[model samples]
Target: MTDKNPFSRRQFLAATSGVMGAAKLYGQGAAGEATPAAKLALQGGPKAVQGGLPQLVRWGQPERERMNALIDQTNLFYWKGPQTTLLIDRFRQTCPLEHVMTCSSGTAALHIAVAAAGIEPGDEVITSPISDIGTVIGVIYQQAVPVFADLGRNTYNLDPEDVARRITPKTKAIIAVHLAGNPCDMHALKTLADQHNLVLIEDCAQAWGAKFRDKPIGTVGHIGCFSLQAAKHVTSGEGGVVASNDPRFGPLLQRFGDKGMDRLAKGGLFEVFATNYRMSEPQAGFAAAQLTRVEGIAEKRSRLGNLLNDKIASTPGIEPHQVHPDDRSTYWFLMFRVRPESFKCERAEFVKALVAEGVPASAGYIPVPLYGNPVFQKHGFFAGRWPLKEQGLTTMDYAQVACPEAEAILKTGVRVTIHEGMGEAYVLSLATAVRKVATHYAH
Candidate 1:
């Protein structure tokens, strides 16, 4: 018997608990599966590695030391300090964008971008489902609908063809997120966006410093957003930037966050309605210091990723995401594809096994299905709106929008961190652990 009051609190609690329990089950592995704790028991509980492979946490000492030194040199109020200004100048010089506006977080930058595009209530913005929930919320916060398209099987980026299918007269824009710092097929996406006259926003939050063909990533779309969260390629603890060559969009972004005036001189104190999303100077200072070493950092991360890929690819049933011939990947995580057929145990179980072997592994970043996350599925500012409520809306409504490939990828991918500070030795150890686990769990 189906409960008629599906949205009732008790029903909702039970339903949500079930989903979270399932996710945890997959995350921790099923009963009797070789969990990390089990492996630790077998291996005598986390001893020092004498041979086979080095440890997995060695990629940031030198860089961090240098960054700290620079921070110490700066005054407390050095928010828009010299180093921060210099980094902005460097990006502008390289990308030749008309303007760039920094913000407190990537999500904030996304909000600014959405507002700049004039994404009114009920307007639809098409994006990939294989991304963080922030991507979806950014649209919803603007009172716009998040229309998800599937990702290409190979690139894990928004499939241009699916994007075309989802676009309706109500579609105001499309956000193309380059998954894992691998550049999306911008040429194809651009072609589609132009034909429809829709705004093309690049969610380059992961693909900072990545390149498509010869052109840098953020330069291709109408506007580009980069994240500087701790785990990202470049970080100032938590900060973001919105960039665009479009003269109109750039200033609009600044105004969206800065009390709606774009500058202190624009109007009376506390002028237009705005959120305080501005990036602070210390974060800017840290980011500026890191910017000086970005190329070196990106290069090191690429090298470690390549090293792991080379070793792991030799073993059967494991594949890495394909980097297109023209794409220069600044891989944020060392992701290896685990073919379900190749393993005796489930992918989640395999992850626990890897962790047991002293590797810090995870299920990568499985984007919450645009309609699946709690924010969209239940009450939030977005759902409270008259138009959205009138639509009998939930994230489930978005589930009907197609994107099978993205859904599958989100369900089955595992990733390990390969920071810029890691060396070949650490990578080889990771490769050895993955191989050992796969062998033990061979189907």
Candidate 2:
């Protein structure tokens, strides 16, 4: 052995072989030594991370240029405006759907989808229980019953089996929300929808660059809805886009968003009754600029999120969020669940420990399922009574709805926000913090 090389090739091979042999001592340790218990940060141990993670800037020169150009042109209307056309073209380029229409907000986009699906009074639309109210607002406004379905314990997306069981003769559509940018099992959902002859709508509000088995999420369903709210991956202050490939529904989306007037048609006759949900030129300009940065933003976040998951996969008492191997999740938030049996502490205590260890974490998602909300339970929309149920057209009752899995997940889950600018080292430190806290509390 020389001072520079440190060891000969034969010596190096022998040492590595011995290390492999030590790994065979299962339950003892990875290298033939008893593992020491991790010290809790709450008990005066050093924190894993020393400082805050990087902050993401929502606007920059690109957004400024787009807004400036729009202002110079002085065209604020979306109809036949340059900004609107550019936004639609850019959205199609990214999403690659046959037809796309920009709207005022995510709720408006969903309402357009509901109208295009031909949802009428008393119709039933099935969707995940753990989602924003925007997902079901359109269904209620259309006088359709929003049937809440249970979610997968690991993925937090809609469970296809539960959705299948919830399907009834009155079921007209299924809205699959890509919760936290994790793609739902599109294939299974599509199969169920086809068998029932129901329309499948993909709510991709949280999933800008997510893919399901190599296919973009929104394209897998009949109509796809997206959001451009300030908090989403792409922002235009507040806006949305609806896309579709089905010939029957594609044209209808455009008309529904423009107050039932076919702007492309030679003459306007008001063919369908609808409200104006147009996206203004300024919103389109900003959204178009933001859209250009989505690919890079999603790629970086996915890499960091995956690295964090890999680091914590072997941590005792910690269960990382389950994602399909073939799918690409754009990880809006990195989530994990605690195996309560393996830990002495509850979820609240576990999260408190993590935060003390310099990791950004929250207790869980929404406090309750959507059906448990006061509006649904009291049938309070449109003067305090559900007209369909009152008229005997539907017997759906929100108070009777149950989603035990979603409730349980809400009780045990924890999440950390993932941002495009978060570096790999920061993510790894987050993982270290999680493992330290979890191991310290392990029973």
TM-score, candidate number 2: 0.91
Q: Please, what are the lDDT tens digits per residue for candidate 1 over residues 1-443?
A: 11011123442243223231222222122122222222332255452122433333423654465456556664543335554565577667545587788788888888888888877777889898777666666787676788888877546788788888878888889999988887888999899889988888989888766778778778999998888888788788899888887876876877786657646364445444668787766677667666656666556665666556545543555655555544566778756667687678888888887776767678756665666655555535443443564675433264255567766766667788877666667766776676667666665
* Residue 77 alpha-carbon offset, candidate 2, angstroms: 0.6
Off by over 4 Å in 1: 1-84, 264-273, 382-387, 391-396, 399-402
Q: Each candidate: what lDDT? A: 0.67, 0.82
Using TM-score as the measure, the top candidate is 2
TM per candidate comes to 0.78, 0.91
Candidate 2 structure quality by residue, lDDT tens digits, 42-147: 7887777778767888789988999889868866999878888989888887788988889999889999999998999999999988888999998998899999
Instruction: Return the top candidate by lDDT.
Output: 2
How big is the positional error of residue 333 in model 1, measured in Å on the Cα after superposition?
A: 1.0
Q: List the residue pairs that clash in candidate 1.
A: 59-421, 59-422, 79-281, 344-443, 371-395
